[model samples]
Target chain A: MSTSPTARRGNAVGDAWVIARRSLKHIRRQPEMLTDATIQPIMFVLLFAYVFGGAISVPQGGSYKEFLLGGIFAQTIVFGCFGIAIGLATDRSTGAIDRFRTLPIARSAVLTGRALAAVLIGLLPIILMSAAGLVVGWRTHTGVLDVLGGYALMVLFQFAMTWVGILMGSLLSTPQAVQGVAFTVLFPITFLASTFVPVDTLPGVLRTFAEWNPTTSLSGALRAQFGNPDVVAGTSDAWPLQHPVLYTVIWALTIIAICAPLAVRAFNRATGD
Target chain B: MAIEATGLVKRFGDMTAVAGVDLAVKAGSVTAVLGPNGAGKTTMVRMLTTLSQPDTGTITVAGFDVVADPTEVRRRIGYAAQDATVDELLTGRENLIMIGELHHLGRVRAKERAAVLLTQFSLDDAAERVVGKYSGGMRRRLDLAATLVATPEVLFLDEPTTGLDPRARNELWEVLDTLVDSGVTILLTTQYLEEAERLADHILVVDHGRIIASGSARELKRRIGGEQIRAVLRDRSRADDALRLISEATGGEAAFDADADAVVVATAGGAAAVAAVAGALAEAGIEVDELALRAATLDEVFLELTGHSADAAIEEPV
Candidate 1:
């Protein structure tokens, strides 16, 4: 009741934080919502490290366990997009977004809040996977600064993916549909990249596609920063793998720049206030 | 006028939801948009609330144009949609505080306002409980409370009691009455004629994307004549004679209802008309099963205006 006319113009940062706090409350009320991000990533780490680590070999003298850690970290962060998509879609279907749209707040604050919460939530899987990686004898030979830089890049990539999630969520009408579409589109993209296997082992068309996949740059950057050897020497001679850190940063920024505007526009149409 | 809308038209694909409607609501009065399903009541409310834009029209709410300055309009009005719009995961207090914060109320003020609203809506007991655990009436009260977080000058409720039980419906009506008494102009939509009669200062009957009738509740009843003199015949064979006698006594045309085996005539004179008809029927030896005189209801008025019963209006498509 004390809202001033100037304040009604919107405090994007404060409003977005308020919106983010709401999402955090949801996580507190229903811990099961975090299951896919936490337990699932840990399960993936254990399965691949114990089951597939023995057979697969890094092209260089590096341990496959160390090589696999970078890939797992990259895959887990990208999958965080699934949570964002489903949460936004659910908000839309439940009329939460409709109520928010009528409020005297910036339209972008709603998505900003969801995006921020997804990034915060994304941190859990990264930390959990890192712990699982250490348990599986995955050690980083690089210095402390490089390790921090690597995690920072991974978080940035997750932030970029959040925009993609928002776009998908805004376009889809139902939470179930968002989950279905996110799985269908993201599954092939994650697997086709160098996340689980060496790009050289992929057949002709997939190998060429993997060489250019953003996930390839993300995983390669993490591996290089962690001082883990590349999976295949001949296959990853491309510009993205050659300067993985720079390429990863560029890919993340580009995805955010393109997806952010499209997502906002789609949100306006979807909520329609 | 607190709200002025002229030639509002909205169309969805092949269907016209609102077709060239106009309205002028005073600064402090309750106006009910009375209609059945698909009568464009929801669409009209949506447009005025700035939740949806009209295909072509001009609407101003609380002195600001809905399209040109939606932010200003939104700042001045509150809307509780048909679908309850509270976050089920958050507690009722949390939902209200969140909305208050979104409206740019400072953190302290937001919390203070949330407390005030919870108590006002009689939701203080359920304030800390998650909305998902609350019953239908509690959630609806919370949703309405959420809209009042900023203390809006005008309130728009779209079918506020569509699915509530009779008891809960009456409770909500009392809450709305208190809000109106506080000088907040209200525009509510309802399918129930009784609801409109009880709550509305002025009623607009909408059918098939158009306003079919508009007047005060009493004036609308007067349009169909003051009161109805209804009589059930003892024998269906004498329905014609009973109808003729009732019409002669009341000096009004009387019609026979085969379904009820009754003759009903509309008359300005209330008890006197009923007595005269009874005497005439007795003189003709036309036995009567029952007789009564009652004020003309909005239901009868709707039937006379639209050539269809109010209940039948529910099944029509928008």
Candidate 2:
């Protein structure tokens, strides 16, 4: 042949970027794909901040609107799982995975690319919700370092949640199946935590679960860093609430430690020869 | 050989999808694996393209072992699957550019190549349009263009024209013809005998996960005694006379087909035998209800070799 196929070896990060760009373009073309990160979080802010803001109260003396933003940030970041799961499942069903497998690029690029894009997509809700928070009378009355640290924690938690999403996407066979999982499994998991309310008000059994849940710790950590209402120290015996930042770090690392390799293994098994 | 395989076998649980098959395709030549739906044509293509591992086999494409060096094999080959595997959300040009970038072509070169391929595939008008809005034919063309972004040496097409209409299929066939002229080795699978007859330099007829026959189209037809001229008689009483006249005219043995109420004779002569039979029958004052000159179709060849119709669906073991 006059133009023989040239061999070009691709590095993992570069290859992953190319794959991620494809998904990011999908988001651009179908902005509806970001509904979970954009429209849903804003709707939750309106629902909880206005519709239910009057009925609920923070544990300590603080504005309920300010307390609600931290929880909203935590809840939306966790739901970042749905986007990756649905994206991977759609690629699998459409035979796009097969096409990628036949290419000379690094095999891990497919999953890593989706994970990278998910984390980036996770930022949309954080930014949009922060704007919504300000409009709803929420403020972070803290120094720049503490606010940066809180945003850092949310991104770190988003990275952890991306792995969980990879695992779910690998296990599920279809986008419809992923949707079923998002509603039946993930929806309940987010609700069971202290996302919209204080753990102290939950039922006895659920209160313990909420205090230990990563979503609760993440929310509590954001509230503490933002100088919003939080659990009064030494009053509650729950260690996770007292040390929310450290607990959230532990939870984030633990999740990545457990789910990352399992997600990779599951993805390899699903697409392997 | 551009592609070679030996003792290829793949089993899914209790069922064998490809059973001890072998192949050797020469450089710049086209080979077609002709078969029914469940005849393991796709399974074999998957193995050859390194998309699936064979339980027992050795396959080498472009001189690299598929099992031992799949990356090398992947670098030299392109595959267009039965399904149009392009992303629906991406525009045609964007899809090609993405694949080009994945192939590690620099961004400038990738974009330039995408433009060229778009125009070549007659997709320039819809280059910026998302593939979700493209017609079935356009999608397949874009899928084919994506595979050609790197100008792969060996191409594997699994039923490339399976869902396309006749005009689209012909257009694709013409593109393939040009590729072959430029010395690209192709291994394609199809259920259409006409497709195999038109494009394949060699044909392998697969059934029940095994190749029951292999040769050029003409050779396979010759094996089934070349063309057959069948004359359905208007009157049953003239069957013997018609048979005798047909045999005399064609200088071949003619038989009475009780099931079809016709006299059938095989001939190496193609259309000329039909003229001779017509003249002889007219001279004898006999009228034929229907007369036809036909070559052995891939379906007829399958029946001749395996005693089953081509459309008989074999249960695919899950």
In candidate 1, the residue pairs with backbone N, CA or C atoms under 3 Å apart (3 or more residues apart, or in different chains) clash, namely none
* C-alpha lDDT (0 to 100) for residue B283 of candidate 2: 96
Residue B25 lDDT in candidate 1: 92
- Summarize candidate 1's per-residue lDDT along A1-273 as a digit string, tens digits: 222343345678988999999988887787677787678888988999989888887776678888888888888777778888888999999878878877877777899999999999889889999999899898999999999999999989999999999999999989899878978888888888889778888888888888888888888899989998777466567788788789989999999999999999998888883
* Candidate 1, residue A150: how far the Cα is off, in Å: 1.0
Off by over 4 Å in 1: A1-9, B231-246, B253-264, B268-293, B313-318
Q: Against the correct fold, how does model 2 do in TM-score?
A: 0.91
Best of the candidates, DockQ: 2
Cα displacement (Å) at residue B307, model 1: 3.4
Write down the worst ten-residue block by lDDT for model 1 chain B. B309-318
Q: Please give the interface root mean square deviation for model 1, in Å.
A: 3.7
Question: Chain A only: TM-score of every candidate?
Answer: 0.93, 0.95
